[model samples]
Target: MRYVVQVFASAFRIRKIVNDGEFCILYSDSDPSIDCIYVTDKWILSNQAKPGGYYIAYDNGDSEYVEEDEFKMRATFVDQD
Candidate 1:
């Protein structure tokens, strides 16, 4: 499965993965219409973060844009468990 996520000003698809207690990483290898983010596989598993959805994952776990109701239109994104 794949999910459309928006991070800041970019949008990208995240290939879905089962949240097992193992390391996982998400990235892109070409000119992506939206930039992809790299997260330690362990991070996702540790956080029990579900895949194949939208979220607002950030260093501070805060972003005004994502808080807006129009977030879905701007870019579909996420990283919260």
Candidate 2:
């Protein structure tokens, strides 16, 4: 299974997600047609460096807005199995 996590930005900017294990941060700035990032893993960690930044989690092909605090907490449990 794969996952995609995105950090919300007001302007057209690149957001990065930390690669905890099998997942790696992906930047899609090459096309310029679309601005986004992709990830492949069970869980994704959002960029906690920026506070108040909106975060979205995509799992099982579904996306939803996630809280920053909750996002960080989830990242800790990755790769436990």
Q: Which candidate wins on TM-score?
A: 1
lDDT of every predicted structure (CA atoms): 0.42, 0.42
* lDDT for position 26 in model 1: 49
Error of 1 at 63 (Å): 9.8
Off by over 4 Å in 2: 1-54, 57-59, 76-81
TM-score per model over all chains: 0.32, 0.27
- Top candidate on lDDT is 1
> What would the per-residue lDDT of candidate 2 be over residues 11-70, giving only the tens digit for each residue?
212245456566555443223544554455443433332223333434445443344565
lDDT of each residue in 1-81, candidate 1, tens digit only: 999974443333344543334434444222254345545665564545444433344554542212223445665445422
